[model samples]
Target: MSYRAPWWLPGGNAQTIWAAKCSRRHAGAAPRWRRDRWSTPDGDFIDVDHAVYESRADAPLLVLFHGLEGSSESQYAIAFADFASRNGLAFAVPHFRGCSGELNWAPRAYHSGDHQEIDWLLSRFASLNPARPLIAVGISLGGNALLRWAAEWGEAAARRARAVAAVCSPLDLAAGGHAIGRGFNRQVYTRMFLSTMVPKAMRKWQQFPGLFDRDAMLRARDLYEFDNLFTAPLHGFKNTEDYWARASAKPLLADIRVPALALNALNDPFVPASSLPRQTEVGHHVTLWQPAQGGHVGFPVSHGPLGLPGHVLAMPEAVGAWLLQHC
Candidate 1:
């Protein structure tokens, strides 16, 4: 069957773009991994693991942020890096706190809208590539953070980065929680997320005995309750509603100044289609892309080595091409 670009992209060229430019078979060559470590303004040492492709010493840089529990090694990240390399673009993917095979300090783990880290990274990038065009592409939770940051920074962020792209993003945290908690999704995703999260929560309790209520933490069954009691409060929000209202990308879509794109699948169980902000609301600064099918961040069928499984996988190249054209 012929490929089709999601409805969000303009024109009919998305298919050709997907096949020729975005294909892993065409993206070319594996990239070498390198780590960039720095201290956050909050006094925490953080590292961003990057894979370089082509000569980036003086070219535009594309910084990628991965999905929940994803690092630079994620298929999407690697594929995007490979695509960037083939297109003569530079690329980097930052490893979220505690995700680079190291535990984070402080009892708290990373949450959506953590822009302080993004600030730390851009400052360094600016020093190196002051004149170089920069684009940020984030997936899933990382995407949510990027969008929130873009909304917060607005034109300042537009001035700092050439463009931003987010795929399979959970624009509304509460809506996403509700969507993911339905049917089989609830069991699969909730269980999987908690399996990874519970341990971290436990570690936090160990570090700050009085900071978190162990009783509530122990009684938590899913991400909603866990985030409501543990994540929101620790992160400075009053509660889950507050956190969701503040952190979700939907609220920030109108504030984006730099050219941006938010792609979500209608069937993505993790993010409700209704949570997506309308194109009219975000103004010309943002483009909304939605395909008929794609499960969460699992756009598995694309023109790649194993053949990208979902339509979501083709987003990076589309974003890269759009950036190249516009920036």
Candidate 2:
């Protein structure tokens, strides 16, 4: 099933904003989540929320990795949880470090291309349920990291998961960074991210005293500057440019061996259409879905009176169905 934006939500920015602010009210029923905190190999703990229908013990497990600063409570996560519950599938959302309503003990926080973390977490999930099939989906930053894991693992990735999907991910980090740093996106989206991110970094600094230049981190006005100051240095990258170049999943799309879907909206404000890979650019096992109008992660299926956005389930449901088909 393809996406068609509601008539009231005309442009990409409107679709994106409305879905983020108002779509949750239209998300019907929420799944009952059981939270589990697992200790990472690095002595840090990551929280995972599980929604399982006990009756369907043999069902495939749908693992969702959320976007930057997003948690299990995120709109898309809840929507996907509802989709899994309705379909009788087991669902899981693993929180990236320091994103689960609590600060992590580790000196480092999560990044857009933390593929090693993805590899470890997913492998642990697979090991815990050897009998059931695993299907993974990542949104935005989480999506980029998941794709990196798949590409790095190649055919080896198939042993742990039947399929994978990335929704509205910035496959090309440089292009995405440059796009999000300009004009209205810089004013609104970038600021929204840094509002949470900068404070988090400051808290991390308190944990590990003098971890980075606190003054430079505070002066960061955009994602590029913040990443340069905090994300790159904390993650062992030389700088923001190095991090974006090495962490990007676009350069290695052809290396993914598992059944993978890279879905992007041509009008995604964060990810430019020009950076999206073509059919010939990826391996035969990979599929690219570049719809004309689903802005960022917002694919509004309906709209209410007076231009209020309604349900944003079409994209999630469609992506969920695709993952299940592969499983």
Best by TM-score: 2
Which pairs in model 2 have colliding backbones? none
- In terms of lDDT, which candidate is strongest? 2
The collision pairs in model 1 are: 299-310, 300-308, 300-309, 300-310, 301-308, 301-309, 301-310, 302-308
- Model 1, 1-327: lDDT tens per residue? 112444443332233234323434324556778887776667666677766444756678888888777778666787788778777777787778877777777556678878766766776777777767888888889888998888888888988888888878888888887876677666766777778777777877787787777888787777778888788998888988888788887876898888888887676667777777878888788988887665455444443365443243355666678777657
- Cα lDDT of model 2 by residue, 63-173, tens digit: 999999999888889889888877888889999999999999999998988989999998888889877799999999999999999999987898889999999999999
Query: Which TM-score value belongs to model 1?
Result: 0.85
TM-score of each: 0.85, 0.97
Q: Candidate 1: how large is its RMSD?
A: 5.5
Native-vs-model 2 lDDT?
0.90
lDDT of each: 0.73, 0.90
